[model samples]
Target: MGTRLLFLVTAALANGVALAQTDVPAQLRVEETRASQLMPILHHLTDIYGPRLTGSPQLRQAQEWAAQQMRSWGLKNVELQPWEFGRPGWHNRLTEISVTAPFQAPVLARALPWTPSTNGLIVADAVILMPPGMPAAGRAPRRTADSIQAAKGGVAEPPMPKMNASPPLPTRAELLAYLESQKEKVRGAIVLVGPPAAPEPDFIPQPMRRTDAEWMALINAPPGIAPGSSTRPTVEDGRLTRDEINATIAEFLVKNGALARVKDGGERRGLIRVESTNGYGATPQVPGVTIANSDYGRIARVLQGGTRVEVRMNVQNELHPDGSTAYNVVADLPGTDKSDEIVMIGAHIDGWATASGAADDAVGAAVMMEAMRLLKTSGLKPRRTIRIALWGGEEQGVYGSQAYVARHFGSFEHPKPGFAKLSGYINLDHGTGRPRAATYFGPQSGAAIVAQKMASFRDWGFMGANTASFRPVSDSAAFYLAGLPSIGLYQDPFDYLSRLHHTNFDTYEEVYEPDVRIAAVEVAALAFALANDDKMLPRFDANDIPSRDPAAGPRARIRPPENHGEP
Candidate 1:
């Protein structure tokens, strides 16, 4: 009887221990049924607030709305963290481009942000204006009619072009002189540039997800530098920089009373990509617009055929001179035991002005908000405080997160009070797709812990984790540079690169509901696990952190297309 009673007690203790181990995560998962709550937040951000350009009014309003939402959920320290932005805010009010003379046709176009308005409507004759071209070398060898006939008769022919021929590039002086000669032609005329060749249809299909083999290859690949990681401006032999040359051209056009500059939309399939002036604080002296490729091509063809083509351009843009203050939405869910330590999750709230900026980042912000809500409602108290940061000015150069990190955690040379207290930071900015795996910026040990914590989420598309020093050029880099452990969740490709990134097509319709909800649950589970872990994730030694090269100029700004290549 005593032996039987001991066995029963042992089995009961085993079952109790198992339940204790699984209860929190299981409860967290149960709370995730409320993950659908993310859609309303996303809708309010993308649909109601529109594009949240850095330093713009819409972004400020969105920041306030997000803060209110967090506070209502009983979060602590919910506030908009302020940062200084020297530039005035800019947004497009109206843009109309049309062919008036040759045929009545409306042109699809989007105004470049920070460009001046056309006052009202300006209708003028269109002129093709291309930047001066470099001089070419010797011409290709010609194929005579006799050679053509010989080839038809099965005779061998000589190679067409002379591969040995080469030519020196034109000097800056020559190029400027050629541009000076076109001043009269562009005076009072609408200038059209680019489309060196007409766009063709794309037949290749875009892959939705990276295969397990591809993911493993990426995980095990050697440390590679991300594009635009260097912050230096490119200057050719100390000559004029590209921005300087463009500024010279723009000033020249303004001097000649050019109506407005127009260019191809830079992508096929009628998608418009709009960009701002190179200098963040400076506004363009002359108005500019990027029109659909088809419209641009038709107008160029008519002018090439010696027929006079007239176009009408009407643009209205608002510049808020006082909109110099940028804010980041920050809030905290207090912990019980290790409340001094912090675990962070963040996403950028700013985007380009071309579209609603839904897929580029709004989905990320919504998922983070939902994850925090899930942790709070599940009644699972973490040991370390879990914080949510919605950053601004990411589209330009990740200014918001950089400023936050600098204020809270000092640089590699110096350490701040809060530096030692940070457990880790996870940033999501890849796209709207579900996270497939995570990449760590610290060490392999940290990644191992993350893999173990996230193992239960395998069915949700999270395969595993790996150690990688270089992270995608997102908000996480700021923390990584400060010697803190940072993790970036790599997501499936979906249509982010092909259709939604920084284009007019980045709207709510592109976001998939299931992907985002599952992503929230995964992030919540990981955060809960990490917060309650016995010890914090290890940080990189100061020596392990990469120091900036003094010779490189201020970190180069991130242009979405150039910087967001696959890891």
Candidate 2:
């Protein structure tokens, strides 16, 4: 009887231990199964609030809405943190572009952000001037009547003009000279200053769908290096930067009586790709539009074939002056014992107006918001405060996040008390896909800690974690540079780069509901684990981190494509 009783007790104890081990995953599973909650929140942001361009009224409205939502969920200290984004605010009211001469057709286009109004309906002759040195199709090797007859008689004709032979791009001086010579003809015309729109290829490179091994490798790699990592930028020789060239061209166009400037939207199909100006706090001198590549190509070919073209442009855009204040939405779930220590999760709230900015960042913002909601509703109290920051002006230059970092934790170049109190930061900005892994951008020592924490949710698609010491390309960059542990979630690429990101196609329809649900659950679980951890994540020595070259200021780096906005 005694032996039988002992066996029963041992069996009960084993069962109890198994149940305890499964508790976290069980909660996470419940969260994932109920992940559908994200869809409505995403809809409210993308469908109802729409595009949240930085410094625009719409963005402010969205920020207010987000804060109110957080407050409703019982989050503490929910507020809009204001920052001075030096750039002027812009909003598009109306835009209409149509070809009038050669053939009448409506040309689909969107005014680039911050582009000035056309004043009134500006109907002008369209002049296609190839930026100096772009090859003009050489006159097909002159076909003589004898050569034509020979070819007709099955004999090979004289070799055609070398179609590929073209001169090197002209120097800045040469470009200016060419424009000057054409002053009489170009005055008051709508100049097509865009490069020749290349024909769409049969296949475009796609983002690698992350495999299990690839995801695991990312988590386990050391800092400052990862698969497909590129070398840091260095100061260049005397050649003028692309921004300089563009600025010069813009100024010249405005000075020379140009009505407006039109460029081919470098997007697949006829989709529009919009971008903002490069000015720190100014608007473009003249109106600019990015038209569909197909339409732009048609106009260019007509012009090249010696046919006259005329276009009518009507744009109404408003620019709020400098000193405009943009905001970052902030709220926190207060911690118990370690309230002073912080674990931050953020996503940029600002995006271009081309679409509703759904995939580019709305999904990111929604994921963070949903994750916070889950933690609150799950009745789990954390040790360190969990803060959610939805940053504005990220599309501009990571301005909002940088300002927040500077104000709260001091600049990356100068550390403050709050900087050390930061346990770590995790950012989500890749897209609407589920989080498969984590990327660390600080000390390599922290990778082990992250890996151990992430191991708990391995079944929830926690592949692994990795480290790098490069400057961040996202909001976490500020924290990373400040010597705090920072991480970004690596997500599956569900056509984010191929079709939806920064284009008109980035709408609510493109969002994968199931994936977003999984993302919210994963993000919430990670935040919970990080905040509840007993020890703060380790930081690396500044010397160990790869510092930006002093001479190579922000301008020297290879920036994302204009339409990419901010990562």
Candidate 3:
């Protein structure tokens, strides 16, 4: 508040903005804005905090730690706003699985987050069930030739509805409609059985786009399951209309008589890591768990042959039912000139409890913390307020961000005021691959122009990286839905697709220090620039996509930003 202190603070903030732009003094560069000072904070977050599983104790600790750290660094209004929603909270505390049966192998996997848990002892031989391919009685065994031929676009038989089953599963349309409703019939106990495969093995299926109808057409028409061992079956999740397939699967389940068909493992088979923030569009399994993929495949093979395999898994995950409420962490560092106007950066602090959720976002939470620290400590006073959110329940269809946006901006019940004043929301939830680039995701014409402006201070060439855009998947989507300008920061990944993304392997060692430092700096600098920029980012073209009319229920929204694919 003194003249000297004010001058010093002004000078330091000016320097932060300048150093990011032009070549600066060695002393300041080496001392004030270097990456090394940021490491300890990152270490504390990723290492000490470990994995901040959503709604778990760790997530709460990290949230409090972040708020305290930010406030200590001189941020005001650093309060954790409790988010109230239908399903504000869900978690899996302890999951112990022992394969007790013929040829028993200790299961090496965790159930997905928000999945029900088991407490009873139930055992059965592991079943390897394949996808709904042709009835093995009429089909050949799986082979490389079969895989290869199935990869091509030639079906042998017309599709036929799955028969000889219990009852019909939820229809595709039914599933889509259900997805909108944020509700589920969480029963007594549910065991997470996924595809049984080598742990986190790296593999990619041939890229093939097939919708539910297309897949059914492939199945019933000619030779649906790979003919002999010549062709391969492929599914490109990105390009396919998964909702349709999910509905079909649901319908099949309902039509078929089964309690729940769980998979055994991850990746190779249909089993995916429950902790992973990523998800297949529609809920793959409702009444059942996505059991071990390997187990399912094995069971399918036996069934295909002349062997009948009956396996049962006793599952028990009891919830308090009375005690379940999730919360989101919302803290702020007000600006001097434009304190009410906002510049928000968010990352889901909560995680799946596989292996301390190190990569999925432990790195992200740390980076956001570091970015806030940089802004707070550096004595930077921009024109807009800087807000950070450590969202809870994001893994369960982005409930945290959705709740906050609805509460502050607008929601299903009523639209809130102050929409026009919100400058932008910046979110960083991708793992610790380093902030490679910022996606420019708004409208095409306007997005191009805004992207150029951000390129000015993002010394990492992030503007060209294409992460600053309107991808309706992460927390950013929540803000975008309100018609405010926003962006999501992205970093490079180490085994993101195969190992880390959301499995136990997402530990501390996997995060690249240099990459995180670079990311932290990029995000901080961009926050500064966006806060200081004279204009707001552009909006998506009205004609680009149809708006959500609330005709169906609210479901998880995800989008692969334009022009990003495997290298």
Best by TM-score: 1
Model 2 deviation from the true structure expressed as Cα RMSD, one decimal place: 8.4
Worst 10 residues of 2 by lDDT: 554-563
* Candidate 3, 237-336: lDDT as tens digits: 3322323453444444434333443544435533345533122212333333444456545554554565534343544433333224567767777876
Give one digit per residue, the lDDT tens place, for model 1 in 230-255: 33454457466545655666777778
Off by over 4 Å in 1: 1-23, 134-171, 195-197, 200-202, 226-242, 281-283, 469-471, 550-567
Off by over 4 Å in 2: 1-22, 133-169, 199-208, 217-238, 280-284, 411-413, 548-567
Model 2 earns a TM-score of: 0.85
Pairwise TM-score winner, candidates 2 and 3: 2
Per-model TM-score versus the true fold: 0.86, 0.85, 0.64
Residue 453's lDDT within candidate 3 is 45
In candidate 2, residue 117 scores what lDDT?
A: 88
Scored by lDDT, the top model is 1
Worst 10 residues of 1 by lDDT: 133-142
The local distance difference test score of model 2 is 0.73
lDDT of each: 0.76, 0.73, 0.52
